[model samples]
Target: MSGAVWSYSENESVSNEVASAAADVAKGASAEPVVLEIGAVRAGVRAPGAKLLLKGPATSDVPPEVAAEAIAKASKQLQPAAILIGATRYGREIASRLAVKLTVGCLSEVSKLSADGNALAGERNAFAGKVVAKVSCALPAIATVKVGYYAAVESAGTAVTESDVGQVNPLVKVVSREKKAAGAVDLRSAKVIVSAGRGVKKKEDLPMLEELAREMHGALGCSRPLSSDLGWLPEEHHIGLTGVTVKPDLYLALGISGQLQHTAGMKDSKVVAAVNTDKDAPIFQASDYGIVGDLYQIVPAIRKALASRR
Candidate 1:
């Protein structure tokens, strides 16, 4: 039997990146015109003529429980063939809770989805994206895909009537809300990102990275080993297969060797520049611009040149 793939929508993700991936999967399904369902929480775009429904508003941080209840409710109404969610923290939580409640198989961090005969196929990262492992499951399958794994594709379809999920009062009420101070810079959304690796030698050397980022109007990022191993930078600033997948307009890698795992994360960036002492480093292959020199001299020169211009 064929099934539908559903994605959660959030207000910030109106781009519909996640929803588009779901539609792309639906197009390939054996089922006729895959059904697209959006939860009350808006993340991405709602496809035209797609079945839009309210799974009840999320109780802020209570998505796990809220999503479980919503999925159970949606199951009765849509009876989707399969459920697809993003691999985001909240999305994963929702998928996990729903999977346990429904007692069905669930795939996480899938980069590709397809059909192989009667079974569903999924491609996900393993050993830090070193290998792409393929998996399959029977019908009524559920999955959560990673961001940047699949690009959103346009499809020929129109919007359908809203399902009007009918409000179900939340059993759990949010007792308190704490807002953490925003970081010095929001690197995730920054157009340019200057990331460093272990080659920086010491945390005191980070000022140079920050200086370059300032001149370029970008934020700072670091490799996994540098941040996790040395604690030089916060975990939030790490970017790589083991860290964050970033698609900035411009990415400058200072002292980072382009490991397959690290390269996979930022491969989507529009422009990549690398500054490493070793000209044969793997990062140079992915970089649009390369500077083979000591970061100490190169970074200061670049900083001075920019300061002179400013």
Candidate 2:
């Protein structure tokens, strides 16, 4: 309540999202929201109110361990009331280390955050999303905000200050950096996604499902089995609890059993539609529109419907 609430993320896009989360929490506690930038300030990064640049380590990139050290050293002087980090792998490590260094509480994968003068409160899905758990920590705490929950802030604040936190060494040395495949997809930003499930019989049939997605101008996604077990698609395309969370305009689930793990990730979609041969499939319960039919027969019909309109 006495100090500013900070937001940070190693990823550029996720940083803006955390800014929005921090702003909401700051407003609840009557505090200012500040976005923290390490190494160098990024033009794409935004803050709901103010921004802080911590100079040290590499100007381009630094390991999470080194980043945690820099933030901990700087925080000793500035002393924020709360620190919100995006729930990215790098941010998770940084937040955990920062909390330990500061000897404060750390909340993981929480959203719908609030500040109640003395504490920070938020909600998190637990038990594979079968239950929503309410969790909180006292002020001067650290939290990792869930992705695909908050919209990214549109404007950047002009009030910014820079501090030299001093250079720090990394525990793990970088060997080499390789670019991802040319057409890698980020399902987080996709407006429309068609996800496959165990109902898909063979890997050879994947292109047919992919074609269906392309016909609807949507990206192809899958459940854990298709990606993890079958290796039909990369893990990036997997939509589930242990995979990526998506909040698309439309999420079409094909042959996916409405398992809680799978539904948890896509539950935030604006509209959900599912096609399964079994009328009692759990996926139908989570869908806005449910079709009790075979996807093999249904997919061609949907494609034909689209072609007729074109």
The lDDT leader among the candidates is 2
Error of 1 at 270 (Å): 5.3
lDDT of 1 by residue, 238-302 (tens): 88876778889999999999988888788779999999999999999989999998888989998
Worst 10 residues of 1 by lDDT: 40-49
Give lDDT tens digits, candidate 2, residues 1-310: 8788889888888988999998898885668898888888888885557789898766847778988998899899999999998998888999999999999999999999999769999999998888899999998899999987888867755777988998787768889977655666789988899999999999999999889888888899999999899888888899989899998999999999989999988998999999999899999999999999999999999999999999
Tell me, what's the RMSD of every candidate?
4.5, 1.5
Query: Any idea what lDDT model 1 has?
Result: 0.71
Task: List the lowest-lDDT window of 10 residues for candidate 2.
Answer: 177-186
Taking all chains together, each candidate's TM-score versus the true structure is: 0.75, 0.95
The lDDT of model 2 is 0.89
The true-versus-predicted C-alpha distance at residue 45 of model 2, in Å, is: 0.9
TM-score of predicted model 2? Answer: 0.95
